[model samples]
Target: MATFEEQLKALESVVERLERGDLPLEEALKLFEQGVGLSDGCKKELEAAEGRVQVLLQNRNGTRRVEDLDLEA
Candidate 1:
């Protein structure tokens, strides 16, 4: 399995290629599909990492405290 960074890089490459507007319809479609899969994988990896960070933050000071992160603030 590719690492998150690798998947992200691949997705970027796919976007760049698609933006060139030179690929045949079939080829572009294939790349689009691959890009979608890569994007989903990257998202899952990021969510998992965020969960880990939250766990660490909550466990600081040898006590387990649960809190929702307010990213919108």
Candidate 2:
């Protein structure tokens, strides 16, 4: 299985190919389906990473403090 970065790069390539507007309808649809799957995979990986980070922050320095992740900056 590809790492998160590799999967993201594949997804970007799929988007580029679809955006070129030169493939047959069936081929384009296939790429679109693959892109959706990749998108979902990336989302799952990211959510898991976020949960890991939250765990790490709570356990750091033996403090056992839980901090909300400020995803919105």
Each prediction's TM-score against the native? 0.79, 0.78
Residue-by-residue lDDT tens digits, candidate 2, 1-73: 7889988999999999999999999999999999999999999999999878777887546656657777799
RMSD of each: 4.2, 3.8
Model 2: ten consecutive residues of lowest lDDT: 58-67
- Give per-residue CA lDDT, model 1, range 1-73, as digits (tens): 9999999999999999999999999999999999999999999998998878777877547776657778899
**In candidate 2, residue 34 scores what lDDT?**
98
TM-score of 1: 0.79
Task: Give each model's whole-structure lDDT.
Answer: 0.92, 0.90
Off by over 4 Å in 2: 59-73
Candidate number of the best lDDT: 1
Error of 1 at 54 (Å): 0.6
Best by TM-score: 1
